[model samples]
Target: MRVPVSSKIGVSNPYRSWKSATDPSPGNYSMGVDPNGGQQIVIWGKEGRRWRSGQWNLQFFIGIPYMSNNVSSFHGFKISLPDETGTMYITYKPPTQDLFRFVISWEGKERQLKWDDDKKKWLPLQSEPDPDNKCELYNYCGNYATCDRSNSRRICNCLEGFKPKFKDQWDQENWSAGCERKIQLQCQSTNRTSRENGKPDGFKKLKCTKLPDLATLLPSEENTEACGKRCLENCQCKAYAFVTGIRCMVWTGDLIDMQHFQQFQQAGNFLFFYRLHHSELDGGRKISNLVIVIICVVVASFLVASLWLLWRYKKKVKVSSMPCCKDKDVAIFDVSKSKRKEFSADLSGPSDILIDENQDNGPELPIFNFGVVAAATKNFYEGNKLGQGGFGAVYKGELPGGKEIAVKRLSGNSGQGLEEFKTEIILIARLQHRNLVRLLGCSIQGEEKLLIYEYMPNKSLDNLLFDATKKAELGWRSRLDIIEGIARGLLYLHRDSRLRIIHRDLKASNILLDAEMNPKISDFGMARMFQGNQNEANTVRVVGTYGYMSPEYAMEGLFSVKSDVYSFGVLLLEIVSGQRNTTFRSSDHTSLLSYAWRLWSEDKAMDLVDPSIRDTCSPNEVLKCIHIGMLCVQDSAVHRPTMAAVVLLLESETPTLPMPTKPTYTFLRSAIEEEYIGDAQEIVSSNDLTVTLQY
Candidate 1:
């Protein structure tokens, strides 16, 4: 198969399948770069992630150990991440490029075919998931569990010092939850109330295997010893692996998608160390009966004393800051009674498709009582209100510590705000990024649902981007920084974070600005989660603003990461041109997109720059952003570039980027206001479920 390659994502990177066996249409499968970008590839199916090509070890995909046995020149496959000088590309040369064919089959399998002139047909040379071993499937053994096909009867097994999370499920051959530690570590962890033990943690080494997915790249280490030492010192680090091409990589949280390999136990062939309790590393030592009895007696006495203290503490906590029901969704925390209030969620719900995600995510979210929130916002005085939007009104407040906070108060009457309130509480609490707004905590009392965030002194992007007096304060360079920040945040949502998120509503109003004028993407209530390798999903009830919605999502309720990209493109153009997507009107164009495209086609792209920064803006930088924005707002989702690509445009290996086709023309604001409502108030009402569609 012939394919164009690049180190950067998006352009000439992905290979998608036909709709069906005979019908030629786009299917739900694609072979593309790994979203996590660990120098590997991933194949996504209609369901989720189907398979991965393992990690790159300079020679080949380390996951494909058998590749070492093949002496064919097929090893010409090479990939390099783009650098400042544009030295990035992914190139592959088969023995006969013209005769070889590559395809993502309609049946959701990636295939490499060789044309046989003798037989007058194409012959398949390779396929993923191995077909023969069901264990090859993605996360078949779940977290902290490895699938070993060598064990025909039971392929799934937990590592030493671990046991199945759910014994009943494991007994029934369901290892999705995988395993849990048999004993607690000395340092801080979910199960541990605090750092109690004095002993240090240790590591257990394993032989060749596919490294766990989503490994975060770390700085270069002199050797595996240094890598191990660095990971071992960090409390969050769970495992560490060192590869040839890619140096040190450390995995935090639960490790998933690990497999067993038969490669020889050598220096660089997939030897990874998993973290465990130091006691678990004892070399099968036996203790004397008398010594064991003495230790047991001492531990019993300590437990008795600890239990009494724990009971008294729980009694005080249960009186106020906890929920009445074990499976309750809301907790009436009384922050006024204490400086810190704890979250009471014995349940999970649908935000990014999983509620209360993990121990590291849920319990960590703080809870502010209604009394404290009310006092901070001066009983929600009219003057304290920052702004009112689809979700509700945001109020500026301050804690007793003099820390500023922005409280998003869900409208009691608007049923729409309730879901959004819960969503923001779940999604933002788990997400950690500078470009993304930080969610401090939540407040729930009776009908009040309030989400507390670190207050942005400069307010939202729309506050300055559209304000006549404040617009010029953000220069051309600052505007570019805002664009890049938003892109980074969007990229994190889609590819970097553990959760694959799609922000359905991404616009100027939703972009918040810090005191430093740095941009942070906010308002995740309309966001949805994409599980595993899931590319797209359909919904009947559509949400979000009109002009920002993607064509497919607005008309058919189909949404994905690309939907956010389209919205971002619109926002990007607005940042550059200082014009709203829906309100722009020119002599020959009705919307901002059409006007920008018209200028670009006429070689007057410079005319699209916002008047305020035109004098100070670098023409080259401005032109590059406009071109990228045009690519993002493409009418067809297939043609739209991924956020990862947009973020990496600076490092593009090619000197000249591809020219973007004419974008899908946006709506005429005059017609919208005439047909729907007279003002912006009615269009973006407090009830967020307002869906305006064309055709």
Candidate 2:
């Protein structure tokens, strides 16, 4: 069945029916490249062409949308042209040196399979025309229609601005007749010169879509806008799209074989479909503007009334009755006469008081005196120094009542400045949870900005988890409790709290431990609040420690709750193995995640438990935790479980956990340190290295 280098290999109708297990005869189906040098690989049925592998685009077969450059990188797929001998061939170099083959079965299913050493059988890596989504069968929806597998009722649907050509057939679940444009294109009747006189057509942006078949690449146009103008000038142009690698692509005929993907499923490509009329866009814009105007008026009126009420209340209230004045244990002062004058001269403002008062309707934080804080810390001496963080040096301080506190004194040269200080106040002041650090109050005078928090006697989890001598204190049960506590805190931030939050810098050191050894998540500097149901966001300035950051957040500046989940996964693995994800190395495994994954795949997951806790650790519990950790570190953010799911899996034994894929292995300690260390300053020195960048 091997075709010569210069010859064509194909399947024909008569060869497809040979069903004998040991039969050397061909079946009723035939497949091969067209000998006329069309480059497309076609499978022929008894009737006509059944399927096709669209012309090669150097990296992949254009017909298969998911066969991307990454697939080539993983499988080493390539199409080689013939030499003077006049032959061409398709080949692949497997990721591993495993026995492999490409075959077309009796059912006409083309598949690429590899021998599975463990299973002792051939396992198909890829099969053409997925059975579940029959839309992949070429032009399943016919002309001017798109196919979406996510659509439950029917896989085929008319493209936007179109309607089914045959309404009866559409209702009957027959889409062979496809669809037609609802409004006639303006260019149909008007000439290019006359088109400028009336409302011109425009493009409707289709986010994350597979472009239709028969796309013409416009190389002369450097950008999309230019290509758009070119398409608009042409009377027959139906659609256009701007692709990163291919640049401008235009379609003149009906759009076919189109597919739409959700935001999470999309790689990078999008299709900009042309609209037949300007009214299609104008109607939506008008409604949006009206809504904006109404919202503005309501918000403005509410703000004015609120301000008037506050002003009237302030006139009748006495300063002696203020909450800050009533608390005897808390001291409020301006620190020094010079600092008071400076604060009054520059920083004192009504907005500051308003923000502090309105934050989640929480209690107003008492402003501490700089002098009193300095005295408690012995004039900010080195002896009282507890630790240094991204913000500045933290010192151990005791109030007059012998109440201990950790004072985070902001440094002028530190990456975290007044903005982060305010963020910490707004977030921590309102959050009240057992596993969350408590912010007592803050002090702002002259150039000093400090945050006071209830001191944790045992310091942070990293202090115990990574220290060989101290790690033994954390038995299996204790570590499991710590993991559960952290999960609860994260769950609260993501779902239970009034405001959804993403703790971008979740890590071992940021998790503080109380005297009872309960884990408390600290450091709200990099936390982001998501209003309503907003789950993810993007930022150009990425802030967080290396090793603990998720792949999306680290490489693309995209983050969500799943980002925190990824960090938690790394932390969980570290807690179980008593090893640092970034620093741990062995003869066979370069990183802790790699090592854990190897052990899991080899059914040696119990071996990953730390020797200190091995005697007490339950084999099933440890294995389950490892499995959950691996799920959390999956490459795709969508694949990572929500914090709620993680918590349930940890607490209940009723739910069966899904199998985890291999963890993303892009991170290597040496390479990451070399690339990022020079650009960032070391903030916290512990078992884990935390770095912060000055923007």
Candidate 3:
């Protein structure tokens, strides 16, 4: 006979606390799934939610990323969607021989227990909301602060450019007051328009961060670059972050619940905040005046001393010289003095020399002798040649140890001279990343300058990406991976590395693929380092590849991280469509950018995908990439996403993407032809048909 309960049976809340084992009355604490249907298990205090298991993502809960891997073997735990009964449930099948149980203690700690037969007692296997990880505590560090587990002394600290709001409270270990910006944002002031006229506020990049809370989702039509511009334009915007799954997330007021992770942990998110230029931040007016004063004084003293010395030297020279014309002697003396002055200036500023070979100083990098490089490359034989660029020809070489290497030998007539060669050695040698090409060593003898790198068996991305025969080998997955890899490398250069670098010539050819088909960014001859919050710089000599150059960079000689983003965008489009941006000419459009804009506007974006990979590629993923690529190639540098955002967009399965505005169709056939002619004459003659346009 079945015993029937008098009352209707309902699901018991684990969060509900019991006064005692004998007392059936419930206490204040209660635990249950979130009623908002967010797929998170939450424990509630008398007031509100005390703690929550992060949002579930079908496979595992995101907050505890390692949960699935750790618990799968012991208990096959799974969350089931609502069925016809309209009831969502979580279930787990225990191992046949082992016994286990779940429990919520009086203190609101949730744990899984396993029976140990030998001990004849229950053992706690795992616990939710681990107290040791302070991040698990809600708003543990308060607003505008990030909790870092790696920091043993203090887990909480304000974000860059921020300071404690209540100094006394902070010192007393009370972080509830949070922090505030040390300097008020220029855009927030009444004289914002006038202040912005001189130098607009820019973003300070923060890497490896957990995004803050209460982020407003930007419009679907906005890219990360546009998102930044929008935030800068608005006085209310405090900080912004862009991730793959979550598009553009801008925080107004105070940023909350942020965290920083160690290098080994997964910290892919990047945060940017509006701030005055580095000069302005540190009392620019006073500093500038003082610097100018000191420089003028030094210059005046040097000039006076030089003139006196020159007069004495001339008198001595006249005494020692044979009878000659006074004017002729004076001219000869002036020419010799000028030559000496130039040589002295060169010695004073040794930007090109990482190490002085003549001084017997140990080089920052290994120096391969000219003879060794020549022998390895078979005496620069044509058969051993790998590729050629504006710098020079790269040849495949094998060392005595059977180690393969790629040697880049600069041509005598190459536009990239000793300056660029030294730049490559200095920059590439210091930079270490999986996505970046490894610089083995260098060789400099007489007029010969060579940069040795780890040999890439697959060669450059263009070798396969553009070639119809080899394009098939790069399936949709491989192509996507390649794009992501390139993005990560750029991100490293722009944000992660010790030095902030802008790869002025980021293109398909510069992207070399390793044996595993992994893309490694090569060729740093054109790269520039930004020191101490210096984001953008200008040069009279504009040097970069033609099609990849951003509008501001190509036209006005202004280059920054965004310039690289524009080139990456162009490369992304090229990879997707299997066409060169400069050479692509169709009946409907003059260049690939124009053609893509047309297709995107007409809602025929899929048509832009290479037909070869259409069958294998995910339509959504391809469309997203196309949209992201268009965003990157936009006319305004301010409207392009950073490399960090690009990496997230490519890697994350973020459903929604910002709509791409009509990219500037600036590719003129005559202009392209003119640039091509100029490049061909000025740069190295290459069979690859690529040109580095220098204005």
Candidate 4:
């Protein structure tokens, strides 16, 4: 339902939730636009202020780091400035969405839940005051301090240039007194900052942390650098943060309810600058990370030198002592004669991928130098950026031989770590398939890691499949070809390959398209390999997109070949309908799977075909594909057909297909669908324009 939210003084109609799921009565919590100030939503509890949906900086609330990168922008949230009557309103209207509502949970957790028609339940979408994150509570850490849930010992810690006001209480686990300044500011003292060559007070830079509350927008300072100057001139300004889509915000009053959230995607990161005395800032200069890197290098070099010298000295002494044995006909044997070996290179990109003993497994993956890659991509210019994800950006480049390549660069702040980088190179190098994306090589220089792949001119399938106009280019034949290619590719990985592999992340975006529009499965970072007859494996860490993940994999961390089949089914239905399975909803169905099943069971499977495809697609083939998709998405893993069988059915029309049972898709069993809602949890939908089309 599209409802109007206003912050008018007299007629503000806020959505105050019930006491619990079962109890439908006025509760102690409420949620609505911030009537006090700013374009934000506030969740109020009985104790007064609870949590806030950080200021809306045109893109998304600064409160949610994930939203800082436009992760929530696709949800179609729009807010209008105060009108002539001094009233503002915000609305939620995605082009295609289901019935959803806002509610303050019994525990004062502001939640956004979507209605699931099939299950007759409300699926949670967004929530504030995350019960798991204790720092979300209003002013929990007090003023001048930050909370870090990741810190196992203590949640609250004083910011730099400050110390706990009451040391006795603080040691006893009480930080209620907050913190006190360690040194007087330049403006606060008659003889200020004598300790650091009379340097002025400076700001301590903090990255990817929640900016404190009660920020006053500074429209005068347009440039971020100018914003810092403006803050320095003002004695009242305690902290400052520059939000991309919004004006610079300076906190003049006490900074409250700050938190140190985990490092986010590059685009999603925001820097918070807290005021500090010059002495604490090393002679009032910006803290250089390069200095830290250099210091570590020096220490490491010293240690290496010491160890080498010690080894050489000991070897020389041993040699001098073994003079008599050397003449006694000594025989030596090589210790490096073993055939089977494993590469143990870490944080070095594709250098970890070693060649197999047998030549049939193919040559070792090529390792491109960083200089070559940087030059090819024009020094990694913004214009050359093909796309940006949690792992930095993808650049389109060309080699000296005129071969085009797609380079995936890893961001230091990215969620993709060394394990994922190694996994991609090791897994892709060992497997070979026409329908699988080829890993040309990689570049590892210093902290920079990049993976080079055969460039796909058409990019990802989602580019065409989701766009209204671009989708027209994907005719029925092209869509069918993509489907068949993906099926055969999955078949090769699951059965024909030397190692039985499961492409955990099998979504439209992961399926790349070449010049011919043929689909090749890409991105094996989250993939798992099964050894001789090992059907499945369980892990505590579950990775993959939520809508496409199988029930067992998403809930119990249990994954196998069947998990890929389930993902394949989701992709199949999406391809047929030209709609996102995650957001698609019908009058009587919660998702595309149930909707298609309902139509199939009623002998009206032809209705499920995308209108664009209906004119050109053969009725029999479309129906058969729908039948196979339903079979692949069955409730149980055993009910789904293997990739081998799926390939046979797609390739051969003569083979009779089995009748599909009713398919039931479930949401994430965990309370938090995914703790970190990075690029993985979101659909990568690129828009031609930034304008929000108001309805």
Candidate 5:
């Protein structure tokens, strides 16, 4: 195989497959990075992680014993995380090349073997050191302890300030009983009186450290001082390490796998564990004035350069302005006059798309010259389009001034007429919040009515929550943030805004995602404005995404703030489960709601959690979210708490959730159509399946 020398395939597998007719079966053993990022390579069997090579030092795999034999040779490899985006490869150029290759035995043994031409059989060059016992498995020694390899039998000894967690487990060779603190650190308020433990049992250092589990990749700017301070602040933090390239990797909770190494070549860079409160970091005094000095020097240089630039620019302008003045003035006058003529006002908020000359609003919302908008959006090109919805197509447009804004071009034939268009403009123009999307004014020239808003970079929540690849990126923390953000936005709509607004259409698609994945509630064309203590209202035109619509609103046109709550509940479940309420299907259940309810009833709600979340996500926390979601989608409007309550519940650890009754109507579309009449007056009639109110 003439593969290029430059090209490499990263293979973490410890074993190689058999190539000849003599060996008929595939290799059983494989080696790869520990999923926990413990700097350990696990030798895995068909069923489970069989044994680990303790953890790596800078030079060698720590758990495996070094060979001092003259015939034996070993080479170890280590690379910084940044260099390892591709697969790992190894090319061994030994002094003697006698048809040697790496192979994994059928029964899961890893070895390097040579072909014996005379014997016509494969001969073993090296086999894994410990042949027969489970005790050879790495980390078999409990934490704060080291396995004494000097003796025929491995002996375990505790490091300073450590003792076994379970004495019985340790005596029985169940070494994973690990180690517990000799004196517990008092983190809780009730443990304040336990001062006899000596100022929260400080850390005892191991000279040559194999860093602990789950090392979080810290930002590059973080230094030793900040890392130390961070580690000290968290009571759970067991140890902290500050390396030159790796920077900070803090370990919290248990320190599982610790081992000793002799004759360290690259044992790892310096690691610090909290032994006791050492003298506070003195590096702050050294770093303070350096940044200020740099800023001052840069500012002085900029100011001096700016004066010279201004003088040159003035001379250039003086030469250019004379000839162009008359031509520019005439052009300006004509353009100004045309602009003045184009400036017409209408009561229906500023129209960027169409100009209503009769109405009295400034220039009828500054309708974009179609040519300018066309050029900006590359002739309404598909590439420039942000997304499309029931109202119209939203395009990503760059103005003449190079300012980017999202232009929502309302569909002319959309079910929502000019009334809804005007309402959105008026409502958005009057409202301003960091959480809410900012309305950057509108355009109305002739038929085109374009409303402009700040462009959110991440598109919409639907793109993320429902996408398999994207959903993995939005882990539990991000999901929780999105949930909290939506809650805040809803709170603004319902209570904080000048008018109490009910976002009649509150689906995942309508929720825009900011660059940071923060959720911004959008699509207000269908949002109803409530005035002066109006708690509930009914609309004949029941408009919203079908799956998200509350039973009261979908079958009957009675939609209130409570209806919005129901939609939010659906959104909440979708966010947590990474499954769409509408598209989800099951053999036994009709919809996501029924499936979730069944899971909740069966006490298997955790099963609904996405499998992609391999990180530390609390099961109780997920169940609590499910409980809150169920509460929000309750059949009775009165039973559901307001957005305010939802926000509080999401934030509080122990929220007193009300017992959610079964929803009044199942999301069986066929069943709903047969039972509920599709009439404006019929919708207005309150029944067990509906809630009715007159607008």
Candidate 6:
């Protein structure tokens, strides 16, 4: 019977080396520090059979190609060697020390063992020598067949375009003879073009493989495309593949040891052969990949130019499509009577009335190619996706000049479609401010509509405040800068810009964070254009997100610039407290605003500040922001301060703010369903015009 106990060393289970056979003395094979470096593990053996396990490679054992499962999986497996006077000792940092052990059993079995929590006993994890024997050994199939570990029945097979060199030997389970080519062809015959008149012999695709070694790595100095080109140029370079992490690898020598992963572990490379002419390779359809590449590049360029033109066309269409609202004072131009001249010197004048109506004397906005955007975004791979929203997914991209860009691909299914796209472009093109996201260009390729904007490396403010690990980065200084920047942006929209516009949607997600953590308001898909004299409008149909909308706007579809003020107040509170307005729920409080109000009334307003930001924040500054947040979110639209006043209070050290009235944070949509108020709108025109709200 075996007795078990635990010792303290690297979090793994520790034990002393067992005694030797002849004299019952302790054995030399033990886990200890290396003489050259104290941080390595060296396995000592009798006489001179010492095997160097090598130093810790930060992630795994250096000498072993088979990475430690624990280390590779990053389950907190670490090895440490402590320096002492007598000798250095080794230890591990696993979840539990009792779970691991290195044992030199009495029967000559030297293995790293682990106490399986599920099995409840010491189990052999891995041995010094791999358990596979005979065919399982490396290069077992005589350089032709592979020994698959996952397969139920062990078998051997030759690579494509080849057959067993010695069939009798292989059938007898002695596969040393390897494989031979099925057909005998000279170098000239291999290139079908040489034999005929420039043609490909053929190609075969192999799949689910560990791949062959040495002979596969293409000679160093070759670019991926060039390497592939070189392989095709030569008859001997049979097959090739451009690996994901690794570049191109080609085979010149005889192919061997090819295996297929069961549908489960499917992982293999392709292997092509050179034995036909150009037309013969791919049913005569396979043009030289080089030619295909050239064609693709030309096509891409044409497409980019076409997309740019299409974007221009769509912009023109959007301008012409603006409907004449039933307003007595506004003069509507008759497109049918107008003579249209070409915007560009080369193109002829517009032939259609709709096209003629869009003609304007204003400067043309820049347009980008859909192909360029696609290349920048790596074809919009899921890994490059930044975030999703009502509009569409935002993808991070880098332009040719190392300029990063955020491409917003509008959704086909969005409720607010072409109107929003055109509105953002028209509004952003005419404005320039530090607090606003700059629109670089736009692309309209078929049904795909993409808007390119200055990339924000830090993403939205919501990402930081919502993440437990990242929230700390939003310190008092950064948070305050964001608040001020947002205020400046609103001030520009409300009073400083050429157009008196209202950013009807002003939540944390809409505020993009740049590399310096500076805030830039983005996603103007739902923004509204207010005439210089217009103050408020009423409608039956209403649209906007909850928690940040004013009461009248949320309930009766009555929206004014005050709606934005209320939303700004919600944003300010979220910034100060580092919490979301929508997801905020408390058993004691009805909403985030209510919670803050309760805290303020109870003389415990400091409790509302995020614990992450509390350390560096000043009590007075935070209290001031809280006070301003309450003032802006006050129930009455008349009571809320203009963005101009809000900016002043935020920047100044002294301001005697009026006490806030009870806020109408929650709007009674009806007696049945109550929607928390927030600023939201749906654009319906290209002139920064929002749609009439209709529930």
Best TM-score goes to which candidate? 1
Output the lDDT of residue 394, model 5: 89
Question: What digit string (tens of lDDT, one per residue) describes model 3 on residues 1-695?
Answer: 11111112232354476533334467556776642312455566667655555444444443453463454553455665556656657666775768987665554555778999999999977544354476766677788888887888777898767889988557545576788877666665567575667555667777555555445666463567877877777767766655544456677756666666564214223344534444334444465788999999999999999888887775333221213324332211212344434433432322423222221122255556566677778899999999987778999997654668999999998888876776777678778887999897776678888888999999999999889898899888789889888999999999998767888888889999877788999988788877646778887677777677787876677999999999999899999998887667666655788888888888999899998988657677888999899889888888888888888888676646677666643545325554455422322223223333444
**Between candidates 1 and 2, the lDDT winner:** 1
Q: Distance (Å) between predicted and true CA of 197, model 5?
A: 62
Candidate 1 TM-score versus the reference:
0.52
Model 2 poorest 10 in a row by lDDT: 315-324
Encode model 2's per-residue lDDT on 639-674: one tens digit a residue: 999999999999874469998877644335434544
The 10 consecutive residues of candidate 4 with the worst lDDT sum are: 331-340
Model 5 agreement with the true structure over 169-242: per-residue lDDT tens digits: 46534466677656445453265565435344344445454444455545453787787777767766767767
lDDT of each: 0.75, 0.71, 0.69, 0.73, 0.62, 0.63
How displaced is residue 636 in candidate 5, in Å? 0.8
* TM of each candidate vs. truth: 0.52, 0.48, 0.50, 0.47, 0.48, 0.47
CA lDDT, candidate 5, residue 341 = 44
Candidate 3 positional error at 14, Å: 39
C-alpha positional error of residue 140 in candidate 6 after TM-score superposition, expressed in Å: 68
- The residue-by-residue lDDT of candidate 1 on 475-530, one tens digit each, is 88699889998999999999989877888889998899887777889988877877
Error at 51, model 1, angstroms = 48
Candidate 4 shows a clash count of 0
Taking every candidate in turn, the Cα RMSD to the unseen true structure, in Å, is 16.0, 22.3, 23.5, 22.8, 21.4, 22.0
Per-prediction count of colliding residue pairs? 7, 13, 3, 0, 33, 31
Order of candidate numbers by lDDT, starting with the best: 1, 4, 2, 3, 6, 5
Using lDDT as the measure, the top candidate is 1
lDDT of 4 by residue, 1-695 (tens): 33344545632437786754456678768876663324667778767778877777666776776565555544577766667876556776764567866677765776667898999999876543356577877778788898888899889999888899889557645576798888888666765345345667789888767777777887777867988999998988888877776668899888888878766536545678888877788565555899989989999999999788766654222121123334322211111112112222233334322323221222256566576677778889888888876667999987654668899998888777777877787788777777999887876678898899889899999989998889889987688889999999999999898767888889998999987787999988777766655788887667767678787776677889999999999999899989877666455555677778778889998788888877656666777788889888887999899998998898775569888766544322221223324323443222111111111
Using TM-score, rank the candidates from best to worst. 1, 3, 2, 5, 6, 4
Q: Tell me the lDDT of model 2 at 481.
A: 91
